[model samples]
Target: MAEGGYIDFHVHLPWREHDPREAARRLLAEMDSAGVERAVVIAVEPSLKLFKERVNAETIRKAAADALDYLVYMRIPRLRRILFSPEESLNEHERILVEHTRRSEDVLEAAEASGGRLLAVASYNPELGPIGTLERIKGKRYLGVKLYPTLHFCTPNEKRLRPLLDYMESEGLILIVHTGCDPGIWELPDLCSGARPSSLEPVARRHRDLVIVVAHLGSYSALKPGIYFDEALRLIERYDNVYADTSAVDSFLVELAVERVGYDKLLFGSDYPYVTGLTIADFVESILRMNIEWRAKMAILRWNAERLLKRLGRL
Candidate 1:
């Protein structure tokens, strides 16, 4: 690891707009400006096969209706209270899934050319089937697999996912699960029900040896902030192997997390490209300006992630 620079625990490559190499270059330039020594670039794979199997015509119709309702609710304050609707519709999610599918190969290729400045974490969708997915990623230098429970329309504890989970545990690969809320179609609570932090408890309990990192600190919701933060704290406090990333969480909440759980289990993450209006430098500066001691700030910014990377033999 570099001597004195931030190790971002979360970031993503630009979607289909840029190819892998150009994406890596842009990401590296951003990191350089932010004083980030390295970053873990997580791939986002919204499988069409999974979407087709899970979503029917009725679901689409309901999504369109809900979307219209959400728009109306946003325009009227009374409707906002009465409906309590989500910001995104199911139809929007379908469009994103179909149009913005990111492959693990793209992420790996980008990181390969990043001169060790980026670490790749592959995305897995169970709809592709475990045997083929595993075979495809076998012997590839991915640090771990990232699972999107809400987007994939499955929970972490599903029996079908056991084979993949078991393989990750046995192979010493970390599991980064998307907790809290997501944007686009998954903004609806019903669609993203599996994203709640509590949903991961069964998996954490069953796989004691597996290292699990909950993304977004269980509070990435744009409409309902910190919705599952307490549950995330519960998992971190109860399970020795469970950790969290502070991506897209409010600064006050980041401070609150330190107060509740300390800095040891919290990793710095910018959720880059997705964090509108703020640069990676802005996220790093926020941590630096916190009221905590320098040691605590450094732990969150660098050392904590460094320790994890070293353990995984990636540093």
Candidate 2:
């Protein structure tokens, strides 16, 4: 931890059933131990309940629409009351909305109690319709919105997500999107095809003012080598608002990011909890050891993200 302290641009809390307080506490402990000043806790949307293991465009399109419908209906107070009043008795669709909504509230509560140590971000399946989710994010304390097209089953440039991207630009909210492959043992490879970084080119070009983050540096597991790193790098180089973070990757890739993407468009992020091999301190130290200037390291570690957050009035 340098004098400015490290700001983790990418972090996650438990997505499954768990105690919110405990989850927040675990994150804080990691921050304190790693000398992290603040970490953005993202409210994650539940994964898609696809009927087939092999996902097709038509199936994804329908699922995306269904996801949007659920999020939109969730905005109704009576619907929320009715569903949550007997949450234990909810069906699959009802449970997804209830769970995602509750997760958003939980992160907000944790951030409130964090005393400035934890910042919150909200994520939704953009293909599902960003309007409802974007509307849900408006006026909230969350500094940004996260989109996981890979797991949630959609692409960044999907026709349905245009309005949501527009809303984010006007509202001055940052967007941290997962733009790589998911090779988790339990994941469906077919569903992740849409997470490619190049899929975002259309939206990035359309909304030049919107701040976009390509997480994991567009790198993927061994199962999918050379996935979208080139596309992510091109996006960062092509658009001033486009940025990338070093999360769930190795130091070699960080070196490549610094050499190729430069420090201004790069942010430091320890994917946390999910990164079992290294500690936050290890990631920081690796950056320190890079063959780059200290100033560049400082920007990646804190100032770069701080500048973005300050513009959004999140700081």
Candidate 3:
């Protein structure tokens, strides 16, 4: 790895069921072999009872603390708890909703237990109920908040959700949102056709200072080869605070994103364990070879995350 260069973000981890030590060993090995400098592990714990590790807007964190605990160490690859805040809109059991709260504590403890290798991304619907979780978790350490209107089943345009967005903006927290087509997956049928990128216009219009992260590369459509090229261009043009990540996005699409959005607004991420680190690294390195400056490439890989960490004061 180049001096001081690292893979800005990596969101995968192993569970008690999977083994964190082994996951860490494997991750470290992979990074060493690939020359990936530093990496970020966004701890996640999925809702297994939700029918087979099904991922949705509600399960935004994507993994459990037990699993996330696997990757924690003294700190070879920095650990971050992508603290997933579960939503109750789809959960009738209230028990299921409370589970997210319980899990948040477990995750925080686990992150601290590893001596601080975790980060949290609390996600919830503003219209659902009082955001006690946000108020409570504020003074503590966390990366920011992640939002998914397309999956948790909220219209980003809803006036009801605005207050929460406004609050987040004032809090100076980073927000991540899934823009574009969610695709039809059996587990999260509701997200198959959720809010589109344009729907975010209302929130973006209101909270210009909020650091918004656009995930899935805007998942656009109607292009000749079916790329999000236009959508990426549009979102960057519309929101100054808006940033895009490489989560679950393909290599070709990643290049398109870099090509269209430029390097500054682009951040490197793997949505992790959902998408492998090796797969992501392959694409990033490939595109970077084609006349892109090393500085810009490094910016996408590290500086972007550094900026967010500084904003969150996580240094």
Better of 2 and 3 by TM-score: 2
State every prediction's TM-score relative to the real structure: 0.88, 0.78, 0.65
Which pairs clash inside model 1? none
**RMSD, each candidate, Å?**
3.9, 10.1, 11.4
User: lDDT of candidate 1 vs native?
Assistant: 0.82
What is the per-residue lDDT of model 3 for residues 1-315, given as tens digits with 9 covering 90 to 100? 345555545354433323444455555555555455544544332233433234543453343243345324323211122223334323432333333232334434434534434455545533333265466456755555555553355556677656666777787866666666432221222333344556666667778888777766665321112234465558777788877776656556666656666778777775544542354456456546645567766777778767766776675
Give the Cα lDDT of each candidate. Answer: 0.82, 0.71, 0.53
Those runs of model 2 whose alpha carbons end farther than 4 Å from true positions after fitting are: 14-17, 51-102, 125-128, 185-190, 224-226
Give me candidate 2's TM-score against the actual structure.
0.78
Order of quality (lDDT): 1, 2, 3
Best by TM-score: 1
On TM-score, the stronger of 1 and 3 is 1
Off by over 4 Å in 1: 15-17, 56-91
Clashes of each: 0, 1, 20
* Runs of candidate 3 exceeding 4 Å displacement: 10-12, 15-103, 114-117, 125-130, 182-191, 220-229, 276-291
